[model samples]
Target: MTTHVQLHDRLDYQSVMPLMEELKAITDDDLVIDAGNLRHLGTLPLQVILAAVKQRAARGQTTRLANASDGCVDMLSLFGFTPETLTQPEVWT
Candidate 1:
C-alpha cells in the first residue's frame, strides 16, 4: 500500500506536530510525501522527516519526497540536502 501526504506550505516549528502525526499514521509499504507547496523548511521538521525516513528504513518500507517547489528545493539545499538525499536512508546519518 502507498500512503501519500501533501505537505503544507511552511514546514516550520508550527507545522511539526501535525506533520509528525501525519507521517506517523502511515502504515503502508510506500510513503509518498508531496512537497510541492513548501515555501520554508525548518530544522525541526527536517528532523521529523529524517526520523520518518529512518523508521521506514528499519521497517523495510520505502519513502519518496516528490514534486517539491523551487523554493522548497532551495530550502533543502540550504541545509545541505537534495531531494534524493532526503529519501536515501543512509544519508540521514
Candidate 2:
C-alpha cells in the first residue's frame, strides 16, 4: 500500500524535525507526499524530503511529491528541482 504524508502549511525548523522523524519511520511501501497545502518551504524540510526520496530509492520503493504549491515549486527550483523531477528521481541523479 502507498503511504501518504501531508505537509503542513509552514515547514520551518520547529516543525521540520518531527516531519523528518516521520519520514525516517517509513521502512516499507511507496510514499506520496502531499504538498498542496504547503505555504512556506524551508531548507530543512526540503532536505528531509530529499533524504526520504533517497532512502526509498535505496529500498526500491517509490516516493512521489504531489499537488505541490507554487511556493514549494519555487523553492524547489532554487535547488534545481521541478515538480516532475520530484516524482522521477532518476532525472536528476
Candidate 3:
C-alpha cells in the first residue's frame, strides 16, 4: 500500500525534477526512505523532498525520510525546511 524512494547521488537541478516525479509515487504504506547515499544534494533536491511532503500532507498520507545523511538534512535546513516536517503525524489515521 506504500512506496519508498532512495535519493541516489547528484541531486542537482539536472536530476531533481525526475526524482520529484518518481517520489510522487510513494503511498501511505511506504516508510523509511533511504537517502543516505546521496552525494551532492542541492536546494532543488530539498525542494523535491518538501514538495513530496506537502503532497502527502495534502492527501492526508504519511511520508518518511529515512537514513538521511547529516549533509542532506543540513541542505534541507538551509532551504528552510524544518526537521519537524519530516515526521509523520499520528492524527492522520
Alpha carbon lDDT of each predicted model: 0.91, 0.83, 0.67
Runs with alpha carbons beyond 4 Å of true place in candidate 3: 28-31, 82-84, 87-93
Error of 3 at 17 (Å): 2.4
Name the candidate that leads on TM-score. 1
**Model 1 residue pairs with clashes:** none
TM-score of 3: 0.72
**Candidate 3 residue lDDT tens string, 1-93:** 767676786788888778877876566555456778765777777767766766677777777777777776776566555345555433322
Best by lDDT: 1
**What TM-score against the true fold does each predicted structure earn?**
0.95, 0.87, 0.72
Q: 1-93 in candidate 1: lDDT tens per residue?
A: 888899989888998999898899898999999999989899999999999999998999999999989998999999898998998979767
Candidate 2 lDDT at 48 equals: 75
